[model samples]
Target: MLRSVPSKSQILRYVKGLLITWKLRWRGVDCEGRVVVAGPAPRIWSKGSVKIGNRVLFRTTSRRTSIAVRGDARFEIGEKCFINDGVEIDVWKSVEIGPYCFIGNNTRIADTNYHEIDQGAGPRVDSISIGRNVWLASNVTVLPGVSIGDHSVVAACSVVTKSFPDRSLIAGIPARKIRDIEAADDYIRPG
Candidate 1:
């Protein structure tokens, strides 16, 4: 039997991933499972709580993934979630992502506008809950206080400003439910 060996690039990638994991651990992130960085390391700035479940993969290469939380905000990601390159999540209140979710490249999930509205009042901060088995395509933007139901699919470049029910296919600028999703298992990543 012949044995296979890891290439140099693979080894380098592994080392970089390890370094990133260590940095997250040092930042007081409550990680319960193995979080792997498949691309470049992600930048996580946590001032409150950051919880990650098992087998969460972060893919960041050309565009880096960034997760930031300030004040009393909390960020939680469930098991078997895949976050692709350039995905940015900024939580000023709370953001919860359920299991078996696939977040495509360059998606932005924010719970705050990052600054005060009307130039005087405070920023609108609310919670974002993403249900299980949801697939958000590339360039999708989930604004504050939005809850995506389970087994839903948001098409590419959609801006989700409102919540949608389960098993829906959402698309377009303001992200309306185009139709109901019949059945789909394509979001599952094989072990």
Candidate 2:
């Protein structure tokens, strides 16, 4: 049997993957296991803490994914999650993304308003909790204090401003539950 040879692009990608892995480690990210970075490298700036679980894939393009954690905030992404290109996560408090979730391209998840409403008032900040098997469609904006429940799907270009229950089909500007979907047993992670 003849052995197959790796293409130039394949070899380049392999080298890039190794560089990215080393860069992440140098940046002090808490990676439990392997985290794959496709296309361009991601821009990660953490003044607090950043934790990534095993098998997390970041599919970046020219627009590169960005993650920023300010102050003593925490940012955590669970295992087997896919974060698409141009996704920006800015955490001023905490942002927790569960396992098996899909974050579509150009999606924005922020836990702070970034500016105060009043002169002496502080900016609004709170934690964002995304449950397991959740799918956030492209161009979605998940604002502060929003919790997306398990197995939920947020429609494209939707703005999530409130908490949603499990198995919700959420949509609209300030996202509301279009309907409740039947929970799929297959999505449950095995022990």
Candidate 3:
């Protein structure tokens, strides 16, 4: 059997991953175990805290992933989670991402409005909690004060402005539950 040679892009990605790994370690990120960073390096600006669990994968080939934690906020990415390219996470209060979750490309998760709407009003700040095994499709935007329950799936381009229960199939702008995942006839529960 003949062995295949690695392509130029593959080699470049490998090198980039190694460099990103070192960069993350140098930046004092709390990485519990091995973390894989593919493609370009992520832009992480933290003044508070960032915790990344074991075996987390960050795919940043198409675009870079940016994470910002301001003030005394906390940001966490649980074990076995897959974060696709172009994902942006802004935490002014707190953002907790549970294990086995899938964040599709270009998804944005923010816990702050970033700016005040009224002249004297302060920016809205809140916490975001994403439960285990949740899947947020590409272009999904999760606004402030939203909690997504375990095993829930939010469709692409959804704008989530509220909380969703476990096993829900959420979609549309200002996301509403399309149906219960387990209740669907074609739904197959993972063993």
In terms of TM-score, the best-performing candidate is 2
Instruction: Note each model's CA RMSD in angstroms.
Output: 3.0, 3.2, 4.2
Native-to-model Cα distance after best TM-score fit, residue 161 in candidate 1, in Å:
0.9
Clashing residue pairs in candidate 3, if any?
Answer: none
TM-score, per-candidate, Cα-based: 0.86, 0.89, 0.85
Please give the CA lDDT of all the candidate structures: 0.88, 0.90, 0.88
Q: Residues 54-161, candidate 2, lDDT per residue (tens digit)? A: 878899965799999988999999998999999999999999999999999999999998899999898899899999989999999999999999999999999999
- The global Cα lDDT (0 to 1) of model 1 is 0.88
Tell me the tens digit of each residue's lDDT in model 3 across 71-146: 8899999988999999999999999999888999999999988899999898989999998888999999999999
Q: In candidate 3, which residue ranges exceed 4 Å CA deviation? A: 1-19, 183-191
Q: Model 1 segments beyond 4 Å from truth?
A: 1-19, 115-121, 184-191
Task: Please count the clashing residue pairs in each candidate, in the order shown.
Answer: 1, 0, 0
> Cα miss at 86, model 3 (Å)?
0.6
Cα displacement (Å) at residue 91, model 1: 0.4
Winning candidate number (lDDT): 2
